[model samples]
Target: MGFWHTMVEVFPRFMPVLLEGAVIAVEVAAGALVVALAGGLVLALATLAPLRPVRFAARAYIEIIRGTPALTQLFIIYFGLADIGLGLPPLAAAIVGLGGNGAAYLAEVYRAGIAAIHRGQREAALSLGLVPTDVMRYVILPQATRIMVPPFCNFAIQLLLATSLVSAVAAPEIMFRARNLVMETYLSPHVYLLAAMLYLAVSIPMSHLTARLEQRLKRSR
Candidate 1:
């Protein structure tokens, strides 16, 4: 059948499966965002630590994660970790792998954002007799969060895209469902097109919202 013919006949059923995938994709993205933020904060602080060993370890992790392909990391976490009795479910493994990879890049982003703020802000906080943690919590982070949000939002989109790789390990996310639909229907083109549109539906709005957020943050400064 022709493309529209395929859409008319199959698209309705295809949509439910694609929507399921999109839900999983959002879960994976949200889960990884949490992990990335927490992990990035620790690594970013480590990179700025006074001790050389702390800084070296943080830098090494960043380099190693950045140097390797994310697919390899997923494989290692899903298959290789299983060999050591650390087997995680497919979704868990994907989240851990992607979040770990994201943390390295986010660490650099956080470090740059923190560094970009004026030193006077930190000094003024300190002058008020605020503790070091308080200074960072109140004075530094507010501004750094603004600078970090754009890149961080971009990273969130990248994380969403990367979730597609989890299918290799048998996670039944959108791409996985689409591939199954292709095999069942012999309609690869239509199946993939539907999936692409579904992804676009989520991503395009997110990008626009984040762009508006970035503008608001900049204006507030």
Candidate 2:
């Protein structure tokens, strides 16, 4: 049969399976984002810490993580961590691996957003007798957070796509599920096409949301 003929027959049959996989991917992304956002905040703060060593360590971490391929990091977490007596479950490993990778990029996003605010804003808050931490919490962060949102959502979308890499660790995400279905059904064209569409089903809506959010923030400013 021609490719289109086979796809017509197989696509509908695999749609549900592909969607189930996509759901898992979403879960992985959500879990990872919790880690990413928390860790990104710490890293962003470290970059501005009073201590020199703290800033160096944070910059080093961001550099090393951002420089490396995420797949390699995933392998280390999923496989290598066992060497240190820390054996993470596949799904847990996928979350940590993806989250760690995301934290570095998200740190940059937070950093840029925070830095974009005028220095005088921070100084003015300090003049009010606010401690450094209180200044960040009340003054800088409030405005900076608004700037961070659209970019953070964009990163979340990227993180969702990145979960496809979890298939390498057999994490049962969308790509992994689709690959198994393709092997079992021998419907590569249909399964893969459906898988791509499942991803688009996420990314397209998010892309529109990103644009709309950017417009809204611009107006609010």
Candidate 1 weakest ten by summed lDDT: 1-10
Model 2 over residues 1-221: C-alpha lDDT tens digits?
69888788777778877788888899999999999999999999999898999999999999999999999999999889898999899899999999988999999988998999999998998998999889888999999999999989899889999999999999988899888987898877778888888899889999999999989999999
Poorly placed runs, candidate 2 (over 4 Å): none
lDDT of candidate 2?
A: 0.91
User: Residue 96: error of model 2 in Å?
Assistant: 0.6
What range of 10 consecutive residues in model 2 has the weakest lDDT sum? Answer: 9-18
lDDT against the true structure, per candidate, is 0.91, 0.91
Best by TM-score: 2
Error of 1 at 146 (Å): 1.4
Backbone clashes for every candidate come to 0, 0
TM agreement with the true structure for every prediction: 0.95, 0.96
Query: What would you estimate as the lDDT of candidate 1?
Result: 0.91
Off by over 4 Å in 1: none
